[model samples]
Target: MSIVVSLAVAVAVLLLMPATATLRTRSPSVLPAFVSLPSAPQLRNRLMHRLLRRQARDSRRRRSLRLVDAMVCELRAGLAPRAALLAATSTLTEPLCPRAAAAAALGGDVASALRADAASLGLPLLIGVGVCWQVSESTGAGLASGLDQLLVTARADEEVRAEVAGQLAAPRATARLLAVLPLFGLMLGSSLGVSPLGWLLGSPGGWAVLAAGVGEIAVGLWWISRMVARIERDLMGHVKGAQPR
Candidate 1:
């Protein structure tokens, strides 16, 4: 009897799990990630992946700063936030940057649109869109002033990114040069019939040189990350400014 009772209780708990999840789903605070719409159940996860890819692509092609400035300027033109976003994006000469405008016109959720758009990558734009949508939906706040603030943040973020890119310009070039420098030296030594293994394993002096090179490599990476983060702080500032509603 005791064993049967325990099994019954275990089954009962298992059954309640789904119910509990349903209840928790209704509460955004309890959810770990952003809430998903019924229209796209897997949207949040997909958006996150898209956002990561956008960040990666952004590093290679940095052309959106002017686009952000232009968008912000339009936002400050006393237009509705959604309309401004749509109109500004429609002016994009690129294939990807303008998608956000179409998404805006469709009244899609702001967060998802910004994250998934390949031609655009910034935490602030997403936030601004979200806040603007929520405010417009709930109450007619001073949208023009809100947009001015958003534009300022967007510009500041771009400036920070530009500064960091500038800072990394020299160091990144040096890193590439250093990476190939040793290979050339090794090739010269080999051509001259010098024993490469003697330097690789037999010599304490060579080992020390290798260690220093490794350390410098690490430091170079750290420098780039710190520079990017300083810019990211401005990016996140804009993002937070637009949080849910």
Candidate 2:
């Protein structure tokens, strides 16, 4: 019974805690006509989904940076723009890479293909590459030079993100610690044979107290996550010199 109670409490605490999103590069989606705080389970699922998406986006951004660096190297080696793009993109595993590479090989509108893929895949870095490709083609500018400049800007943006993430780490940890403190309290009570869980789950007044405490903790964690996200977005805009859209 004690183990079961402990597991239940842990799961409840975990479900209530929202994951901190370090960056949001995209614009906010259009709101629904009606807005309301979702139920606890629904909110938990959405938080998990957002966390996963953020991880994937970060990974993709790193890959995109690598692609740019590789392209620069290839271009400096005297490869043509189309060939360099294809070669660099081939190193990536994303679906966008292959489609853009194919467009380059087929002499299609590679920039348009890149833009379309960027929009679909939520990879905004690709949009900059597309613009570089278009400008290089229209003005006879060196694509390599353009990409080199972009690489510098992208690296700066990356550094700002890293700094913001490091700064927010303590707050995120503190929030998690606070969220789990109640579990420790329960454990202490159980060790003392106080049967805290029994009281909380068994009695009407204890149930009310449990519900209220959980709700408040959940709201507190959510608020912290929101504040951190806003800080990340703002720092990225002001410090990195690129506003996320």
Candidate 3:
């Protein structure tokens, strides 16, 4: 009888408790539904990755350009093609230079070595340098003149790329501004004593609204970025393909 009375009391206590109390107890086991929370860290990581990749690409491009310029100078200084190549390799910091010098010394197709290194370095412009060397070899043309023309074309292309990037900057800035405007609005509301941050963090409805806002912002930024990238890629592809043979 005592056990039965105790069981009845326990059941009454459970029934008297609020539904939200039970939910709160089980909430720890459930995955969080708020997707927009703490997104800054992820965004920061992505930005850092993009910055590092761009830096690496710019460094490679500069190195490749310098290598070509050096080879041109050496050729003009009356070095034989092999000697010029070796001198240029001496100026480079990468193992690619030594490998290319070795290939030239071995009497192999040094143009092929140049092409391989260009591909590995992600410098599409260097492919033209290899083609110039190959054409000089096949036609008995002046290698120095061919490389000088290549250097001029490369400089022109770099200038054009800079112009295009400048033209695109406005759109990129606008997209970033749009993405950040909602935060400014929230700040303004907080200044007016609306306590939006508190409400969003403290209430379930506000959480849902915050999640939707964040999802929209992410999607809009992604779409804008994708469109810009597609346009830039297409323009670059056209420019690369239009280079003089």
Candidate 4:
């Protein structure tokens, strides 16, 4: 009788705990309309990750872009690159922003800061602009045109990625559903005795079950990864003027 009561309590806890917890929790957040992004952001996430890998988020990407935009605006106002970038850092917190500002404070070049984080945008183009500025100090030949083109291309690529993320949202959510269904089954098993799960817990059969579980998890992960990589490739191809080779 005690054993049966314990099992009953365990089953009740298993079902009710998660339900009440979820119910009492804040409603899941939705993307702001300004962002109006895809619901399954994981499809755009680049890795099959564990704890720290997920946490090592680089919010600096947008900050770096903002810094560049500010630099461009200030330069168009006739400030030098060094001065413009220095002025822009007050509005940015990218890892490279402060260094750019300090270099300017020391009367050093802003091109160095641009070069340092230029790969985040396009290193070669930033360096090329630096070269142009140095060579044609007074003649504004083509520099403005190149900057305009670069910004246009960058914005277009960003839009393409947003669209791809939207397209892959359903697949990503499906993968997540597949991952959770087994857990739900496991919980149900603890109540109904339908799970031959003891065979999974105690012997050579246990090891076999563990191995099979591991393999299934790996396959599910690989499927998700392939789906994401395909989308990434397609997005890049669109940028590159060809289908993914």
Candidate 5:
């Protein structure tokens, strides 16, 4: 009788064990926790970084244009090419100014030095300057007139680019809004107690869906950005190519 009772207790305990396991599996704490997303500070920092980079690029372009205009003025005033270049460097800062001055003073390949400096600064206008210098050196042609024309064309190109950028502003904003719409929707659902994040973090199907959605968003943004950039580059290239070589 005692052995039979003992066996019955053991069987009961085994049955309870599965129930306990199931309960543990279904516990609230057992749900996969969502990873912490980037906080506001991190997002702000990223935005600041982007803004700084854009400003730096704009500043570099502006400085390069100014250098070209200054050189044109100095050249028109009857200074030699090397003298005009060195004078232009007076208004500018390193590394272009210092490098250019050194090259000019050293009596080395001034055009080549200018080209190198322009390349390092990512300034396309300076390429025209180098070309002007090279032509003057090789053929004894006047550089002042060419540089003046280049400056005029460059200004015109900048105006056109500004217009293009203005036109693109709306599209860019729309793309950004679309990229963030999913996040807003998720937040909305969460506010309504729908537990969207919980679902996304907790289940295999949800994980797959989330991954696909994120990938689609990223690819779409990348494609749009790439297309716009390519178009801008093509347009700029066409303009540059049309300029007097």
Candidate 6:
């Protein structure tokens, strides 16, 4: 009779386990009930999107710089404004190049075309080129000199950005290391014959503790990201504002 009762109690506990887990998952006390971990697919998509945007941005910057250098060279070679733009753009594959060159060839508003291309292509650097073109056209200023100055300013801005990135690298690495340290702790615990995962998943109190830890990690990561973003934004804004109009 004693053995039968003990077996019945064990079975009852086993049956209640799933229900307990479900309840804990649905309403973890440390996080909002609606908050849940993102699925693998969601994470993959986000990472891909960020990579593509960075690639596109870098490509656009390179093309803009190349176009400016080419145009400056053509102008310094004694070409007319229209001929210089046509010659410079003819060497590049950027979608904006052909349209701006066509506008120059046809005696349309090349500045407007450049500006339109800059806006459509998400290339803010070209906006400065457009402005230089417009001012030179209206005031009979030296186009080559204007573009050369623009190139110098652009290179300076790039250097500042690179320096800022270098400065932030240490903080970024630190944040990443901090985020991974918990995993190291888990591994250490396992190596010592401690079932850390089992303990964390074994009871309602453990579930609450795990949820709190996850929430804290997420918050710390977000705070670091926000700080980095804010620093970059402010510095970039200051650089732009300090540039000559």
Which number leads on lDDT?
Answer: 2
User: Model 3's lDDT to the true fold?
Assistant: 0.74
Q: Find the number of clashing residue pairs for candidate 6.
A: 0
Model 3 per-residue lDDT tens digits across residues 1-245: 54345445544554455533333322232216653243544566677899899988877777777888899899989999988888887888775455467878888888888778777777876688778889999999999898888888778778767866887899899998897677667656755678886676566776667678878898899899999988887877776677766
Worst 10 residues of 4 by lDDT: 30-39
lDDT tens per residue, model 4, 19-126: 223222121221122122211223223334543353333244445556557767887888865677677677764445454467668876655655664655433445
Full candidate order by TM-score, most accurate first: 2, 3, 6, 5, 4, 1
Query: RMSD in angstroms, all models?
Result: 21.6, 9.6, 13.9, 12.5, 15.7, 10.3
Residue 134 in candidate 6, Cα distance off native in Å: 1.3
Q: Compute each candidate's TM-score over C-alphas.
A: 0.45, 0.77, 0.75, 0.63, 0.71, 0.73
lDDT to native, each model: 0.54, 0.77, 0.74, 0.55, 0.72, 0.75
What lDDT is reached at residue 132 by model 6? 87
Model 1 ranges with Cα > 4 A deviation: 1-82, 95-123, 190-245
lDDT string, candidate 5, 1-245, tens digits: 54345445543553344322322222354223312223234444666898898888788787878888888889989999898988887888744545667878888888887788778878888888889889988999998988888898878888767866776788788888887677666656755669776776566666556656766776788798888878777766676667665
lDDT of 1 by residue, 68-158 (tens): 5555677677666677666665665664444566667787765456556532454445456456556755786765566566666656655
Instruction: Please report the candidate that would top TM-score against the real structure.
Output: 2
Better of 3 and 5 by TM-score: 3
Task: Pick the winner on TM-score between candidates 2 and 3.
Answer: 2
Give the TM-score comparing model 4 with the true structure, all chains together. Answer: 0.63
Q: How much lDDT does candidate 2 score? A: 0.77
The ten-residue window of minimal lDDT in model 1 covers: 32-41
Runs of candidate 4 exceeding 4 Å displacement:
1-58, 107-109, 119-145, 195-197, 239-245
The parts of candidate 6 lying over 4 Å away from their true place are 1-35, 93-99, 105-107, 199-208, 233-245
Q: Indicate whether candidate 5 or candidate 6 has the larger TM-score.
A: 6
